[model samples]
Target chain A: MEFIQQVINGLAQGGIYSLIAIGWTTVYGVVGVMNWTHGEVYMLGAFCGFFLFTRLHLPFLAGLLISMVAGSLIAMAIDQFGYKPLRKIGMPRMAGFITALGLSTLLRYSSTALFTPDPQAYPANLLSYKLLTLFHINGKAITVSSLHLMIFLGTLVIMAALELFIRKTLTGKAMLAASQDMSTLELMGANPEKLIKITFAISGALGAAAGVFVGTIYAINTMMGSLAGLKGWSVAILGGVGNMTGSMLGGLLLGIAESLTAGFVSTGYKDAIGFIIMILVLLVKPTGLKGYSAEEKV
Target chain B: MLEVNDLHVYYGNIHALKGLSLHVAEGEIVSLIGANGAGKTTLLTAIMNQVPRAQGSVSFLGRPTAGMTTPMIVRSGMTMVPEGRRIFPRCSVLDNLLLGAYARKDKKSVRRDLEDIFTSYPRLAERRRQIAGTLSGGEQQMLSISRALMSRPRLMLLDEPSMGLSPIIVEQVFATIKTINEGGTTVLLVEQNANQALRVSHRGYVMETGEVVLEDSSANLMQNAQVKEAYLGS
Candidate 1:
């Protein structure tokens, strides 16, 4: 019963990790940029949700949608102002990496100045904190909170929709092709720059959704993005850099590992669990669970 | 019809194409034959606006292509099958073909053209659901050509289509090039296989050190002593 309870407790957090990991991986796969600002996007998203829910009193779903849209806009703006000009000048890859690191630092500190370093909590009544029982093992009820159920279901729905979009839509297939060979995609008469923009937008939206979810479950602060962003990167690496499915599974696995560690081992080591697993995976598989060897592009 | 006049392309300090001039008349197979690094690939990429042109103009079907992006150039009815058969190896064969028609708004005709491609190359139809990377070298070359055709190009640029294929497959590829030209698509072929290229082409340009050293009817070029000594390996 305790093991089942720990698994249930881990799932919602796992789903959030999956969202963050997916956003990070998508941007890396298509745009070929390590967007360090993704966590900042998530932080902004939580703030977006905070403002909408606390000030405007918007419904939960509406807040999530608005946050996602705002996140995408923020991500697109970053690409436009930060990365696009560098690409146009044919800047070296290191230039882009440094630019990303600089942008991330700039966003983090600015937001810290703007929102202050203090942590703010969402309203306690944001969602009914009811624990619903599933079944009993030896008379101890296995219960899950309504918020956890919502987050888990929401993540599943988003992932499924994403899978269908990637498989069935032309734009999605073009994205896959762009990841493989951007120049050749241009030969097919698809603007790779436009695809890059779309990729950033999608990644930002996913990050923001994750931000909003985290804000609901825990306190939100301007400094939250730093650690969350690092965790997201760890998840991306753990999932196998550019592979989407790998990121998803990696997120879930990390979430569960963290939860179990916190439950049985030690809460002090919960955060370290993800990084340790990442190192182990790198030492062993190196490609994560679902990652395949990338074919050489000529 | 396509035209490039006084074209120059530079890779940083290396002048890849130096004031070269060429044209492909409508319904003609024009071959540009040269050794490696003689700017064949550079010239093709320059024509498509993928690489910057330091000097010169490229006009296709009577309009200047300067300032247009590569996709825009492709949308204007010119496409290149780049060197080494750069197919999206992870995508299914059917998905690869559909991506070829990405710029077209005529969905019905795109489907018809896809069917036409499948009929002409039944091997592609048989393996439409398979990942493209798993295809044999000859089939990949065929898919590459078919992918270029999907854009419904008025002028198609082919770079080294026979680079790593078997001799029999090379003959079949040349035969397909002939059939494609007969069906009314203008072709600009870049190849190291000078003998077969000249045989299949209506006109041939021999490039040396980023300049067109000779241009003439393929029959006359085939008979030229210098061409025989340098390129044809006779």
Candidate 2:
């Protein structure tokens, strides 16, 4: 029963990490930019959700939608007005990296300055306290919280939708084309710049949703994004950078490992679990679990 | 129809193309055969608007195309299958073909074109769901050609289609190019494989150091002494 409960908790937590991992991988895949500000985007998403809920007096679902859209727009603006011009100049790749790091710092400090440092909590009693028992044995029962259930189902739906979007849609095909070869993508009559803007938008939206979920589970804090962002990067590397499905699997696996480690092992080592998993994956398979070997362009 | 006049292109301090000019009439298979470093690829890139040109006038379908975006150039009924097999490797063969119609908005026409491309390249139909990157070199080249055909272009620019493919594949690829041209799509081909290119082309130009050194029918260039020695290895 305790094991079942732990598994449920792990699944819920994995849902949040998977969203962030998706955000990281999407931008990396399309733009070839390691957007460090992605974490700040997630943090800002939670802030957006909080602001809407308290200031606008909107419902939780409405707040979530607003956060997703707003976060996506903000990230697109950054990519277009901020990063695209730099790219036009044929700027060095290192410059883009530095620019991303700078943008991350700028977003973090700006968000902190705008929002209060004190933690903000979502309204209480809005989410139900109902629990459903999945199995019972030896007079002990295994139960799942409605919140956890929502998290699990919502993550699966979103992930499935994203997979379908990338695989089936015209715009998604363009994105995949751009990711593989931007120059060739242009040859196919696609505007690679537009694809990149869309990538950032999608990545930001996913991060924002993760932020909202975190705020719902825990509380919104200004600094929560940095730590979460680092964990998300770890998840990306673990699953293989630029591989979408790999990131999701990596995030879930990391989540379960962390939860189980904290539960049965040492709670103090929970923070170190992500990096440890990354190192292990790197040592075993450098291309990640599903990453293909990069071929040289002729 | 495509007309390039006095085109000048530069990469930083290096002058890649210097006062190059050529013309390809409707339904004509024109070949630009040149030695390495002769700016063949640059000419194609400049015409496709992929590379920035310092000074040039490209008239496509009898209209000036200066300062146009790549997609805009493509939308004007011209598309390029870039140098090397630059197929989107991670995507499936079907996705690659579908993306070639990226600029087209007519869904019914797009579907028809897709069906036509699959018919032309039946191997693609068999492996439509397979990732392009996993495909063999010959198959990737075929995908590249099939993908370009999906765009439904009036003019197709093929840059070195025979590059890096087996001799057997090259023969098949040239045969396919002939078939594509026979099907009414004008082709402007650039290649270092001068023999194969000239054999398939109607008219040919010999480019050297970004300048057109000679222009004639494919047979005349094949018999030209300089071309025979420098490019055809005869």
Candidate 3:
């Protein structure tokens, strides 16, 4: 019963990880560059949502929508000004990674300076906090909250929509092509610059949405992005760096594993569970659960 | 319909193309044959506007494309099937072909052209949903050609399509090149397979150390003694 309850809680939290992991994975897939400040983007999004809710008195849903739009624009700006020029100059891959890391630190520090490095709680009543009993396992009862249910469902919808878009749309097809070989994709008449820009925008929007969800559920803070970003990175590695579905599964699995370990074992070791599983997965199957074959001919 | 005059492309300090010149008339298959380091690939890349040309003019359909980008050159109806069959490995065969028509706005016509590609290469149609990287070398070559064709080009540049295929597959690929030419697409075919390329091409140019050492009708060049001794291995 305890395990089942832990699973439910983990699934809810894991759903947030899934959204973030997907964002990271998508950008990595198309741009082949880690947007280091991605977590900061997430932090900025929550702050954006919080400002709208508190100052402008916008509805929670409206605030989320606005955050996504703002996040996407922010992401586009980073790609256009930050990364694109570097790529045009034929910079090494490591340079892009380093730039991303530098950007991430810069965003985090700037947010800390602006937001005072403290957690800010949003106004309550944006979501119902009513607890619902899912079922009972042993003599103990298994319970869940409406907020958890909403978060999980929202994640599923977004992932499903993204999957459909990639599989069905021409632009999505182009994105997949770009991931494999950008120069070849360009030779085929696709504008890699345009596709890369859109990829960053979508990744940013997803990160923002994850932030907004966290704000409504927990509290908003600049430092929150670092923790969430670390979790998102773990989720990406756990699922397979370039694989979308893998990240989603990895997120859920990591969440449940952490929750169970915290509930059954020591609470101090909650963070250890994710890294432990990640190390084990790397040792056993280096590609993660759904990573594709990487034996591409050079 | 494609002409490159006095082309000179530099890769940093290395002069990759040193005063290279070539032409492919409409509905013709012209081959640029040379050994490794002879600048065959660089010439095509320079003509496609992928590599910067220091001194030259690339005229396609009587319009100058000397300083245009690769995508712009492609959009202008001249596409290159670059060396090494650089297909998008993770993409499906169908998506690879669809991206070939990326610059065009005619959605319905693009779909129709995709079907036409399927008709041209039935093997590609069979593996339409399979990832392109998993395909055999010959099939990948066919996909590269089909992808170039999807752009609906007046002039097609193929950079060593038969570089690493089985002899039978190479024969099939060269045959298909002939058929593609017969279907009204002009070709600028580059190859180290001098005998086979010279057999199918209307005119041929022999390159040595980034310079055009010889240019003549395919029949005349094939019969040339030095061409046979060095390239054809007679």
TM-score of chain B of each: 0.99, 0.98, 0.97
What candidate 3 gets wrong by more than 4 Å, as runs, is: A138-140, A295-298
Report the TM-score of the second chain of model 1 against its true counterpart. 0.99
lDDT of candidate 3 over B1-234, digit per residue (tens)? 787888888888998888887778899999989999999988887787777779978899989996677788788888889899988877889988888888889999999999988987899999999999899999999999998888998888999999999999999999999998999999989999999999999999999999999999999999999999999999
Candidates 1 and 2 compared: the better one by DockQ is 1
Compare the candidates by TM-score and give the number of the best one.
1
Off by over 4 Å in 1: A294-298
Clashes of 1: 0
Each candidate structure's TM-score, on Cα atoms with residue i matched to residue i, is 0.97, 0.96, 0.95
Clashing pairs in 3: B1-B26
In model 1, the clashing pairs are none
Ranking by TM-score: 1, 2, 3
Q: What is the lDDT of residue A164 in candidate 1?
A: 86
- Sliding window of 10 residues with minimal summed lDDT for model 2 chain B: B113-122
| Candidate 2 CAPRI grade | high
Residue B7, model 3: Cα distance from true site in angstroms: 1.9
The model with the greatest lDDT is 1
- Residues A158-205, model 3: lDDT tens digits: 788888888899888888777777777777677777888888888888
Model 2 per-residue lDDT tens digits across residues A147-257: 878877777787888999998899988887776788888877888778888899899889999988788778888888888999999898888887889989988888888
